[model samples]
Target: MAFELPPPLAELRTRVRAFVDDAVIPAEKAILEEDREKKRDTLNALRERTRAEGLFVPHLPKEHGGLGLGIMGMCALFREMGRSPVGAACFNCDAPDQGNMDLLLKAAAPAVRERWLAPLARGEITSGFAMTEPAPGAGADPSNLKTRATKVDGGWLIDGHKWYTTGGGDASFLIVMARTSDDPRTGATMFVVDRQADGVEHVRDVPVMSPPILQHREAELRFNSVRIGDDAVLGGVGEGFRLAQARLVPARLTHCMRWLGWADRALHMCREYVLTRESFGKTLAHHQMIQKKIADAVSGIHAGNLMTIHCASMLEQGLDKEARPYSSMAKNHVARLLCQILDDAIQMHGSLGYSEDMPFSLWYRFARSARIADGPDEVHDVVVARDFLRGALTTLV
Candidate 1:
């Protein structure tokens, strides 16, 4: 089905696009110049401007002092923000933090929200999701979670070694996943660990391919004897797996939305370059090979966008009774297509494309990481295929 943007969303898209062209894009060079160190300084400036423009935190409700935009409107704004890699972050709508905010809003206690969510919402402090761990711990296979959180007097003792915890080093609080029960079926549980809590130690930050926007610092957290009250439990005990799934499904789709914006930008850069940059006795756009690449990139992005909107529309209308299958399909397909599009855009740009001089390399790096970060494509493929075969085989019988 062809999905259409509602009127409010359309206007939101236009406003975000203008914001990207004016405020966000101009700051990209400065960010790249100083790399990770530059983001704090740049964001300090952007935050003031975004707040003045009323473009900050569109997904958040106005009760919390945000724009109070819903799913559809936020999707449109996110796509425009994706146009500039720094766009959403500048507006305080970027991931890890955005996803963290959604979790706290959905499940955190009022006191918890006041403690963790408020500063994050106002862009005062950063947070991280400490779900991914090393080999034996929580990795691609969450079922292999090795962290242990035992009941203790007045609280729970959390002892786990979590790695690749995005935004970990700088996070004020970490939503940690640990195995709380020996019951094979319902063993996993989630606990909130404050950074200042005892036994919560930040290991070295793992360097990643992309620049650190909103401080995407992957760190190893050693929870020796960290403790928190029963209130620390998010959702409920033994519901960690279920809650994590719910948070991740929506989050994966949102990532797809943001990456679609990046893919769109990469294609636009290629289009502009091909039209002006001279090739073998002609402009690159005039060459059949270059034209085909552009066509494919456009088609890939369009298809990816449609699939994303389908899931998002259902989410908005509360029609997504169960969106696991569709969410899986959208996340996997968009990541695959985006990686392909960004690769082609880089190739079309030639050596310059591969160079840090262009954003294509950055886009490509992000595309590659997206495939593994949320869940590997192979894992999603298994999910889709298993469901499809079950339905099809039952029909055949």
Candidate 2:
């Protein structure tokens, strides 16, 4: 264990755990049922329930209808809610939106916040963080960013290509990342563009391995001279990379936590099945190979959990530079750990796991993307090496 939770947080974890097990997990049936209308109804009801219990939007500040829990506090809530496929969304604390809200709270102007962030906080609208561009443009490395935001009279004219912009297909608005200059460090800027703005086009929703749920939907969008007013600027000009770090650093850690919970769910399912299913002369759980797999996964989860907690504490303390090494280490570790755990579960389940009739197949689809999303495991490893060489050694907790 890295550190002990305060008494209040410990108790809160218990309550939220109960809520997830007793309520949210049950709602996952709407997914298998394949009833969109029923799913929406169930989600709306659960949203109200989470709000009533003071668990909704746990990442946002108290004034924005969140718990003001800071980074460390929302961790417990996110882990528990992540048990179900639909869990975190019900509470309005899922990614892209969650990360977007974090940037908005810290950077958006008051009027801009009222017009955009306010409705988004209440879930009246959805937004996509459009930073990843197609190949030959920005993907893992922002230095390759090619989308240009040319300064025009009274505002900026944005022309770009973005793919895998999660939630873009149905989002009411988008936060776009565009290069403003040739200087690599201060070349980028972020702007809020309305979905209905002229010259903005949603090409299509890119099919992914996971189910076609709105949350997992990746999309392609084009800005053909789409114009945005000066008011839409988030943070400041030439501050895009800085502002993005503020969002991505914490976001990558939070993603680690939620996936940690989901991995635990997979392990639980594997354990239950192995104990009941006989192999050779005994149940599969008694097999030495099976025991070894379980042992490795349990230890890996613990290590990842502690790493996430340690990095989270650094963020809470405002040790931004100090947190980067640890954050990179945790994201890479957790992303790889998730895939191995899911693979082990699938191997243990044998034919049942490989089949679509089981949850492992779906879970694997989700876990497989962990390596690529946020930032690829390869990129994080590079970051770890570069930071260590730069003598950024204070963050090795």
TM-score for candidate 2, residues paired by index: 0.96
As a whole number from 0 to 100, the lDDT of residue 186 in candidate 1 is: 84
Q: Which candidate comes out best when scored by lDDT?
A: 2
lDDT by residue for model 2 (188-278), tens: 9888889899998999988888765646678899999998899888888988999888889999998888888888888899889989999
Residue lDDT tens for model 1, 229-276: 988888888988888877888788788888888888878888889999
Q: Highest TM-score: which candidate?
A: 2
In candidate 2, which residue pairs get closer than 3 Å at backbone N, Cα or C atoms, i.e. clash? none
RMSD of each: 2.6, 1.8
Task: State the displacement of the C-alpha of residue 98, model 2, in Å, after optimal TM-score superposition.
Answer: 0.4
> In lDDT terms, how accurate is model 1?
0.81
